[model samples]
Target: MTERTPTPMDLLDFPGAAELIAAGGVEPPSAEAVDGAWAAVARAAREEERATMPATPPTQLTSRRVRRPRRLLVAAAAVAAIATGAVAYPVLDMGGEPAATASASEFFEGMAEVAEDAPATTPAYWKVRVETDNQDDGKRTDTNYFDREGRVWSVDADGTVHEPPAGEEGKVKKWPVGKKWLTWPQLEKLPTDEKTLAAHFPKDPNTRFDQVTIMLEDSPAGPELRAALFRILADTPGMKLVGDVRDSKGRAGVAVEITQKSWVRLGGGGGGGSEVTLHTRDRYVIAPDTGLLLETTHKTLGKNTTTPADRYTWLEVGPAERVE
Candidate 1:
């Protein structure tokens, strides 16, 4: 009779695996959670293989060279461990100072100063490309090209080019821009002063930080706005530099992270609310010379492990060719 491969729990019964899982967290995962996590792992692996399948060849003007980052590999490995019912996350030291050591104000202030003087041009079309990976969603890629005159082109993961729907000539599918969705012009019009910028975003520090991060991460802000955005980040509470490090693409830059905890009322409105602290960390990788954003990653702190919330890495932003 053929022997079946051991599941994470099966391995735990033998030895070593249980200890590792125990070390990963104070409380071991329930059996149901482990099984569900393993299923996710299986699905993720299959999806990854499908993602690697050859697609319709890139256009002559387009290139398919993707510089997947080191952190992405780390996330993938984490998923791999989950297949066996163990999710082990090692300490990630990209060889730099902790978030506490660097100056949040000075770093963004530096980015602001450089960005203020950088050149700006209105391209015929701006293409935004990004790769996103989530603990549940696996990995997906997309490209969005938009022109000043309301033309849009979207390239999906399968290399399918989607255009505007019927009667939606001027409007294509909206970019998957997060919370603070601002177009190029609106972004340019944003207030540069830190105090005014704060007023524009949410009053809640955590929400404001996330909004600012989304703006910086996804928007094709002009040089002036870019500088202003960095300055705004500098002034945010809990924002600090995490020291210089290289991105997955080997682009070296300083990393900054904002760690925030918010007290939430646990009970119903009428009930005396118990305060629960919600923790979130947002990190940004910025090019030292130009102050350009390289990458942004979000994680939620947990008792046992830091949850891999979301990661956004820009692939390109430039003039598109062969516009219809």
Candidate 2:
């Protein structure tokens, strides 16, 4: 009897063979199409592997004997992860009514209460600090302030005041610094719902987002920090609503987690493709009296890739004031 070795196409089943042919075509496949085709091949491979493998082999299956199936399983999992947004960490749900929703609302109301208790005749200002970490790029910090007159100013780490760009008359211009500003109204303008948020704050936007400033707290939780948090929350989808909880700061807040899978474009030109799974957790603290946002913390995780999770905190909450 003569044994016939499997051809490349035969070794892959119909879908896998088709994928190989398509990938090696005269032109590269469209990223969307390539992703779809890869998923199909992975599913087919999984089914075939399962069908061919005996439930109870006469002998134990060694790594060598099970290599093909194992490889197929891994590939299938990866494809599936991309097809569905799979995040490395859990994301809190921002949608639907949860126990935390009531708590969140209560916290906001509380902030309002605190504001009402303060002297209405006295002007209020919000001081903000922002810290960003881009994986290997280390960390950078920026601080700013929002005053009662719908104006924003930059503050150095040591509390040195740097006025926003001013006109010939020394009036501060309203534009964001380097096109970025932070304020309560600006943060409120951002969508919290999943669908609209994703559309508005895409990871890669063709146009830059407008930045504004609003004052909330005298501490680190400022308008700039809130704006950044809103951006991060908007970019991440599939967050599940957890509930209201207390943080180390003894603040009452709402917590949410999301496990998302998404296709991240590679290269600076936005011409390449890569898929990753991310898990993110975020918590929002509202003024227990005023219904204003007080602070936030965000954490993210990515699996089977070099991408690292990010963590940061935002603070400041006060009377609801708008920044132009």
Candidate 3:
């Protein structure tokens, strides 16, 4: 009987063959894929060597063998890891959301420049056109008129003047101006350093979100500080761009939003029957060309329901003026 020699297919059926093919490809295989393939080859080599090594062998691989299935398995794994959509697909879901490709960093950086060049004429007051909407309250628009002297006032469509009850008069009224979140002096002192500005944001998700949005649409942070504020928001954790959107005023702009999950207690048991996490999403719209903040909207989503909690629109016509 004639002894048979193993064919090339038998040799290539071992673990290392895929690595050679990948190396010779038009494009180089990824480091991760290469490493994984080599690891598989080493493991198979060790197992084959252990199973068939002779006390004195004619050659190191003279009696070694690799199963067809094992070779195919390792080759498939390496290919999967190296393929465009296989192992790299999970990167899209980082932070439980799609990663931002075109970051807002440049937009904010440019806005900061425009802000720095803005005239710093201190007005006796600052006025903004304000509109708010909710499911229960419907929609209402008002001209928020106020002065640094702490007097607050609002004008309705009929050109009616509304004032706080004399006794309710405080340093700042809560309806509009007070909700602006940052005063002129405070905005002036806002840190431009990215990390510092991010740190200055409140820990509470609602407040942190409100403060940031207000800074964009309504805060007296001026141009430089406003630009810094936009950068801070861009760097905020969990914040992601929601792409293009039109503000309530129908101006085209870019929208970015952040979602936070929190546990809320429901009354049922002696203490509280159970707690469920609620997801709150907030979105902000900014003009892409001019970098002006246009709108901010918030939604609260529960297991089976979504609520449009708050929406605000700000048209930044600077310099507060007395109501006509």
Candidate 4:
């Protein structure tokens, strides 16, 4: 609503802030609170545009401190984009994990920002070499080349080939954005401007969260769209910076986590009268410098315990010339 990127100055807009400043009534934040307050400010910037004492995020919000100087990458619409206030609080679970320290905006900006400062490209096919490791099953890696019309040519590790169904030649695979969906070409056609680009997504934050992950992992989005995708996630609440980490492949990347909470009812006998909370976290490791998603680790956090779930490590991802 403000149509401007919120800044430190916004803190002064707190109802009694001016009075406190005039009366010298406000207490200076100590060292520990500053980091927490800096994080509190970023969260407040997205939620209420008001400051909170004790430097705690709203109960519904779970945030981590990001380092300073998250500059504006896409200056044109970034102002409007960052000002999207009152985004819904997200559902997630966490353990005594490390205090999140990277800024979502900065992390995305780095990735959104390289290939000639991220020059545009229109490759014939979107290529991805990914490994999916299931907890039940083992690991399987495949290199897939996808055309604009939704056809895929996948080659397995042992040299077997997998192609799309015979009858579906020109039909494209549509990825869900929110309630709606978009084909690969439509994804490319999405407006580059952040405000307009953001309008294309649904208001449901969880829907926005999952769909964004899917598209980024699989779609052949261009530089601009790729940048916009990061921007969307940056603005979306619930991302906790896990700081920098190396993927399983030993490639350097920045990692972040998002948690989702659910509950299941027990059935029959002694446990039948009870319910339990299931808190699952999805952690993503992406090479911001090269703008490639390297790995994703899903974990289930229980009473002071963390259990591993599914994991996906991107072996290779880039543009392709053909679906061969």
Per-residue alpha-carbon lDDT of model 4 for 1-324, expressed as tens digits? 668867765635544444444554344443333333334444544443232224664784532222233323222122222232212222322233322333554456455543225656778887888888876777888788777877778787776777776884534567886567777887877786666877777766656678878878877777767777877776666677776799878889888888887787877776676787888889999876777788988888888764457889988777778655
- Model 2: per-residue lDDT, tens digit, 202-268? 2422122222112232322333234343434333333333446665456676554433333455555
Clashes of 4: 2
On TM-score, the candidate that comes out on top is 4
Task: Please write out the lDDT profile of model 3 over residues 104-153, one tens digit for every residue.
Answer: 43334445555555665677667778788989878988686666644667
RMSD per model, one decimal: 17.5, 21.7, 19.5, 13.1
Q: Which pairs clash inside model 4?
A: 92-259, 114-118
Give the candidate order by descending lDDT: 4, 1, 3, 2
Question: Candidate 1 residues 268-287, lDDT tens each?
Answer: 68868787777777778887
What ranges in model 2 sit over 4 Å off? 1-126, 129-142, 147-151, 167-239, 244-252, 259-261, 267-281, 285-294, 305-309, 319-324
Model 3 residue 205 lDDT score: 40
Angstrom error of the Cα, residue 94, model 3: value is 12
Off by over 4 Å in 3: 1-102, 163-168, 171-182, 203-207, 268-271
State the C-alpha lDDT per candidate.
Answer: 0.61, 0.42, 0.59, 0.64
Task: Give the Å shift of residue 87 in candidate 1.
Answer: 42
**Whole-model lDDT, candidate 2?**
0.42
Weakest lDDT window of 10 consecutive positions for candidate 4: 73-82
TM-score of each: 0.58, 0.36, 0.60, 0.64
lDDT of 2 at 3: 93
